[model samples]
Target: MPVERTENRGADELHRYYEVYETIGSGGFAKVKLGRHIATGEKVAIKIMNKKDLGDDLPRVKVEIEAMKNLSHQHVCRLYQVIETSTQIFMVLEYCPGGELFDYIIAKDRLSEEETRVFFRQIVSAMAYVHSQGYAHRDLKPENLLIDEDHNLKLIDFGLCAKPKGGLGYELMTCCGSPAYAAPELIQGKAYIGSEADVWSMGVLLFALLCGYLPFDDDNCMVLYRKIMRGNYDNPRWLSPGSILILNQMMQVDPKRRLSVRQLLDHPWVVKDYNSPVEWHSRQPLGHIDEDSITEMAVNMKRSRESTTALVKEWRYDHTTATYLLLLSKKQRGKPVRLHPEPAVCEDSCSPLDILHFSEDEDAVIVGSLDLSSEYIDDCPWISVTQQGFRGQPDGLTNNKNVVCEIWDGYGFCCVFCSKKDRDQEQTSENKENIVVQEKEVEIFALPLPRTPASSKKNARHNKNVLTTPNQNANAINSKPNAVTPKGKKNLLVIQQMIERLNQTMCFHRSRSLDMAGTGDSGKKKRGGKMFGSLERGLDKVITMLTPSKRRGLRDGPRKIKAQYNVTLTSQTNPDQVLNQILSILPEKNVDFTQKGYTLKCQTCGDFGKVTMAFELEVCMLQRPEVVGVRRQRLKGDAWVYKHLVEDILSTSSI
Candidate 1:
């Protein structure tokens, strides 16, 4: 489907690069259309929002864009750029072909513990990164999480994101977010810290993921609020004791007591065995809400409604201007009603002592509650990356072969890169047909991971200045290895090239142990105090004894420092399928063991096999312990080249 071209020359001209297809998804006032990028032949999802329908939410739209533009996490939906016309705004976003997490949950009822843990870890990592940058995703739910073709999760919908002024952590006072996932502070309409509230929502999400239902759901709105406020919920028998412990801490009634993102990451249940230790950044203080921004939003809300006079009359100077602005915002979106008649003001005080009252029907539509009646797409087929190949065998090499790389192209799209050979042909067919090319021949390539989102103005300016083009992108592939300058932040093309070079650089060597070195004041104190050192050693031994896998794995010297890298496996292969392939080739005498960490470790025919069953990869690497070398197991006699994967993961021992 081509773009619905209009006479308004501005929009038509802007959309020329894209051939819009059928609406892939829709939201409150926006619709997401599948689009094809003419220049790159990349498939993208363009979210179009009409200026006329935005009403008072216009400021929010700007804020949402501002918030999303700066974020570049692998788990967060990428926003490429914004295109505005006289009447509509187009947000070019990454297209997630796997659809929503909610749909998967509905289909599976509940996920296995290992599967849930993989997704939960990713979400926690993303939240930790975003919180470190001083932004809060106020609305987090299953519906807001999209699964990419690789089954990797991407968080979307930043319409309720809160960024404090001065780039610090700030308390959000607004009664927003979905009721089912809302924290106690949000439900009670209290001013609460953003990250803490996020923790509560995550707890709710985890509970739902494990149990296939929300912990605090109720038909009556008031009953739900009461349940959330009291931290009232039952623990399902199926939930692991470790999981229950973490959830208990996250869903605390008091915001202050709730687990911070850092704590959540550090928790034993979250870390387990396979997940590497994350070095969390220092706490960034939240800034106070900008009065000017709040005031501008309030003004927009007033303009949105014609009869806000009665609503304004009920306001008293008792609350902060920010609070009043939020109240006005609620009036703009939901039911229309008049506030209670003016209360008699005490001569001694300027502020009123009583709270404003609403009429019976309108009272239910108060702060902290949003209408959960919106229609959402839950039937979209799982769009996997593994498609049928032309005939014979598919190209597996990085150079001079049939390669189809998925690019997140800022529009949440699974776009395929076009080789120079196909460029002319693609250009010729741009007008007559939609550029929905299923496959493109290209050199073997790795997509660059998105840059981390930063909140500082300096980072924002840097992002704005970078200009990327297909010609410049080609240079990344063809250019010889050199020390690239960071003067202009490295774009996706440059980063991808860097990874290709890295794959050629690494060689087999016994990685060294990086345990604590050179006795400092802390080390000296521990050594001098015999009882303290003994007590610590005793505790460590006790912990090891209790954990069977850790004890067994470490019995021989320290466990070999396993190499961890980031790679999105082809969509055609799932973990189970890959596991079966590896098992087929294993010797009959293979001493295979299945563990809680979704890992299969075996020793067979002089090969040490470590298979990780994850959404991203179906890794089955055989290590020859005698030579201290690693080799990937062949899948159906085809070389599964993983050399292009970037080694961004930190080793637990090193940290």
Candidate 2:
């Protein structure tokens, strides 16, 4: 029985159809509520999200919805309906009672090898189906895997999934997901193939399931990263040899050496007791209609069969289609996995009549109607006809006047042609209507293109510069010249030559300034050139200002204009704690600051209170797990002063 909703009539429209109950889960911008459909009394998880709270992540939500809509499999969570309002968006999804796989793993401490195999097979099957549909689940972990009432695994949370339109060779540039489950390439911020990255995460998940802990874990994020990069993990002795082999293959340091989802499906460990092999080549057509489901929907909605079928075929995001799919899913429960269904046989004894018309202008026969049955018409409402002639015409035809005509629909096309003279002969022949049916070839999946060594080296160097730790800065700078191309090297050489000439001119000016100072008024009178003397003095002043001081080298002067004036301080504490520590010490340093989340903008005086300095300090995760990075930015200040201020703050804080 559904709960009575008499609280409010104007607040939510979803309440009219679904009886919303207590919240089951919540995130930063969304809350999942247990909802029951009023019409069929079905349990559902309704995710309610505020548009404003979503901000830039709204596109990710839309992508998740699109990916869910494209996927339909037993091991994948189904998206039932989506409702949007002016300020909010609601997504109704399948409710799993067994909760997350992470909780299940924790409760059991560790799963047996046989149980792990069962779960791993299901995950591989789902991944195969996902890849076949041209999508990759970038975020694969125990937390994102849901379990149904029957203890079957169902993949969820496709917010980070990728389906590139640039085909299989396209590389994903986003560095996402948890560090424990992330691949080495992703951690290094390199462009990676979506499927390969997913495979690496799957390896991590398998390890966690078998051992009850992460393969790579450390309090220091940098240490954890180094471990993952080197593929260092301890395999339990209790694990079988096959399991260990598969793990090593899946978690290979090189993505190309990693085993793909297809290969994993056929692995000995994965297929040990799994008798049913996934049919990777089979593709279910989107326009497929189920007669039983349609009949049930028609009865439940109290509508005509034709109208229900029309609504289901329309496939819009409305109540009728949602109810139809939900009912269909309910009927499919406990059934054997069916990748390909046998062709339907017509019950009635009505032969398909072909209606043809001859076109004199084109000198060809056009097929007007191939199948007039209600089912065929409903499946493909539009028809496109083509004419193709056989190599040899029948003896009854004169001058090959009659041509074979073919009719095409959405699913497949059929050919039907005959001559009036040989109509009886054709009827006597075993094949009627000379019809030939041809099915469209469906592509299974695309593999990634091979990468060259040169490209790989270039990407590695670029990624190093993009995401480099303080310890690697010196090495990166030293090796930078080797990465330059011939053209870049030539340009650098030209710039060096110009700098040397400038240095020589400055040296000559300095010597002239010293001589002029010693000679004083007598040297000016000897030169007798006021313009040249004044220009020489101006050049000397400029050179003096540019020269390094005796106490500090030129490197300690103002930072290069092109160089970024940022210092990233790594802290073991959380972002909030590090932020608080910095905030606590700012007041003591006579700095006025404004705080926004983990970022702070500070204003202070530098250079003996003569220059006002302003800078920003941001505490961020920087993609490192359990580590915080305090980054500094000189918004309006001397770079040299900002650098010292950052140093002072780090020294004063306990972070």
Candidate 3:
């Protein structure tokens, strides 16, 4: 009889089943390499894992194999068998002759249209299979997707997979995904719906596939979340409509609103427009995937992800399973590389809730809601520009007891306009006479370098100024008799926003007005400064005249008014007139209204860093007859809601 060779259970003696091939990878677990079976004469791949390699995860090897077995779509790699020994476990799996999807993206910068369609189809197929099997592949990023010798996909990593029965809409609060790829619901620390969360990940993948960049691209996180919620996308005009349609439907903001896998399969981008929809795969409306392999592929699945069972170690009891892994060194084992963490500011700081309101550089401000549908508060003392800067108290709008402003705070709205100006940062000149202020210049705050939106941006040159025009005709009937109900009235807030922007144009031409006030040595007197050219007093009289007597005193000198106004508006002329004219045409609200609807709050509370302020009043042009030239009034009516915005330190006085 011929001598028969028997396999041994020891670590060193078990190398007989195959000849080791070159190393493919060595990571946190163990080294994996290509090998050829000694008796079979065919190529095979081996993943060697030490008993310690499994750590707390040792028992889950069976669960991994179980999930891998269930994930058998054309896009998912298959796990074949397990071998064991006292020292290690060798997992034999289907090897992808090709590599990772991330490499392809970096190498080509982006996927071409045809390439995207093909890859997308494969991804949808994989998603459908896993979901149908009642499982969710939570981590579906490009790197987790691999290609085979024929460029087929192999989605691996079963650690985060879960079944959909009790698992499907369940919330995964584990802040576990990458920030750039994370969905808004995830970042908010809200409960995340399963497959829907996966869809958001898919949306990110699609965006990167097309633009070679992220859609929510921003360094400042608060700003980034605002942009994401805005969802105003500029598609590269170059893309085809079919792809756009699919992406539009898949990326719906509401989780329940997104497309299902089967619906996505029927998507025009997936199947041609001429093709009919794919049939439901299950019998309960969506017939089950009545495939022949279903029964044959079934395996015992009492495997819990957190199991303490030593399944893989038990499999290692056979000699052949314990081969070459025993010789691999620790250095040969390492974790796979991952993307670097995003910048700190890019993480939690940004969000939709932080937007205090939208600024149009006009008459009244929209207190909240980005679309400006929220309420508009008007009639507060808006800063007016004079030759010195602004009117009201000589210190301009800086005086806290008088001046007020609104800023965004995340939770609700906090009034920041109440803050005092930075006295340390103020300009110091002994001359102080003339209530010295800044010169007027056309400055555009919304240019590309400082890059602001075109709609919000104005040119540096003065655009056409809107002169005060009487809207007497429309106002007569529309004011009361024709007065519409709240529903019928033009959004007063909208009207106010327009007025606020238009007001920018009316800023006073400081030097020109000082000439009218008086040009002489009287301009220099200390007592003279307040008593200057004015037969009455210097800017002091102007301050008192503009101050709201019933309440707070004067703010900074009027020059402060000019600076704030200039900073807020692009061109003071036409934009101003346009805003006022629009407001004048607005239908008045009916006094019969009884109930208040709601209040809008600033959304980005986290972005407000601590701040300082400054104020100066600039007198400009000759006094106006119609207007009080410049006037200040205490907070009243709807505007009172925002009066808390200004800081306590600001009082009616020149700093």
Candidate 4:
């Protein structure tokens, strides 16, 4: 299906990136067409709207764009890109194949308690996340809730969304929503909190989901308003007790008395079968990039990895970022891969004592044994290094009398040196040193075993039946040629081979670190001093780079604190005088404002006319006649832009 470019210049521009197909939906001002990305071949919903037709409702479109741009959630429909031509604006959105929840409910007539619970939980989760982001979905109905191919709910249509700059308590005067879903305060034309109004709509949505009909319906708008104001609605006999209880609390006529979105989350009906609470504020920062997605984009798009990374991190909703997101979504929909594979285990069941022993003769050094079970050995792989040649001779010995054996069992390292002469001299000797090396994730324990008593030694001699005389033992200890068992010798050879491999690995890392640190020939100078210093610094840098802390910091980048967006100012002037000063200053600063009493609704285009920033400023007289409060609320656009606008207004105004 090809798009007709004759009628729309926007379609002609969109045809360059997307292949527009049949119209999936149509409204009075805009039409949504099913389109496919030319580069990635993934389907998208392209909403085409003409500027002339939108006219007064253009700001609503801008509000929708701004809201969707800042929001990223699993249950929220994503806006990929926005293409604006001279005559039209094209918004590429996530294509939901399962259609609207309204149609689903109509087809089934009414949902069972269990099925309704599932859908309601998803709606609540999405709304909770939206409210936490400081925005409220004023028009939350089944028509705006879409179901995807996997039957998960996705909240859409943020045209009427508002972010109260004065926090949740800030009241909005807009009474524009579906009459059936509108709260009593909205119907009464009274100022109402956005979140509370949304809660009321959710209660109505809940009723429709379980009862297959509106709680308050009338052909006459006046009668409907009366019923809503009276807070009178019939609960179906089939509705559960928990459902009725929550519905009553949410549908309260007074906004202040109504259950809040946060409180509703813990309601019995909402929490039923919802064992795991949704993490509303767990979104990754915009600067966080997926390495796999970037790599795949680079390969498929024939672009450099560095360029693709920069584009994705910018998150400007450009062609490159859109394609990358599509590829990433497709990958996420596929089967999940395990992050860490299980380690392989050795089949041999030889004990540590057996592997440590090098000779079968009675005069061979008896190294301390590790009584580790086969299961324990299988769980923790061990690497043993035995250096037989001694560097220096010890006291009271003709030859070097110490055997140094180092064992690494994944988490810890142990080094032991045992000598027969030392054991005889001190029967109750115990020497142990524990050293923790956090960077290497290893703990070192150097321990020397105690000597056996005379009685135990005599019993060991009786059991072995092979005891050497003192003179013979002295010769055996001094001798260079001692017969080693084949098993022990093979194991000893393997351990020596492992030690060589470990040394090679360490050298490779050291060289790489030095090169990365740019310490070329200077790092190798003065082997005793400068070399060690350079090596230590280089190793520290390498270890820090490889640590999990670096990855964690990258993954959870700097988040935007909500407090910065909520701006308020105190003035000593009268409330009316302060508001008049703001109005007078806004026009000079290229800001437009519509005033009603002491409140001024202001808007401006920013980011080179790419974003439309809308905010509300209210001036209220304090208890002191000479003092007033100036409060600003961000209704739409970027938070930083709103902050700068408020600062600019305050700086230029005399108030």
* TM-scores for the candidates: 0.44, 0.50, 0.39, 0.50
lDDT of each: 0.48, 0.58, 0.40, 0.58
- Model 4 ranges off by over 4 Å: 1-9, 282-287, 301-303, 335-655
Residue range with the least summed lDDT across 10 consecutive positions in model 4: 381-390
**Over the stretch 142-259, how does candidate 4's per-residue lDDT look in tens digits?**
8788888688898999999998888767889988878889999888888988998999999999898899888988757799899889999898899888888988898989888889
* Candidate 3 lDDT, 207-232, residue by residue in tens: 77776656666656688776665555
- lDDT by residue (1-655, candidate 1, tens digit) is 2223232333443333344444545444666766544333345677777877778998888888887756656678766546765567877777777677865665566887788888898888778877877899988887789887568888988889888874546666887888888888887778888888889999999988898778987757799899988998999999899988989999999877888888877688887866665544322111223333344434645543223333333422112221333333234335232221221222221211111112211211111001111111111111111111001112333243322333221222222333433332322333122112335331222212221112123323522322122233334333433322222122223334423332221111001001212434564333233222222222222222222222232122111222212212222223445444444543332333333222233322223443321111124222222211121211111011111111111111111
**Residue-by-residue lDDT tens digits, candidate 2, 435-528:** 2222321111011111112233433442434212223323432345654434333323322332233333334444565577667687443432
- What are the candidates' C-alpha RMSDs? 25.6, 35.2, 31.0, 29.9
Evaluated at residue 521, the lDDT of candidate 3 is 53
Residue ranges of candidate 1 with Cα displaced over 4 Å: 1-7, 166-168, 278-655
lDDT for model 2, please: 0.58
Candidate 3 ranges beyond 4 A from true positions:
1-16, 26-30, 37-42, 50-63, 84-89, 164-171, 217-234, 273-655
* Alpha-carbon deviation at 358 in model 3, angstroms: 59
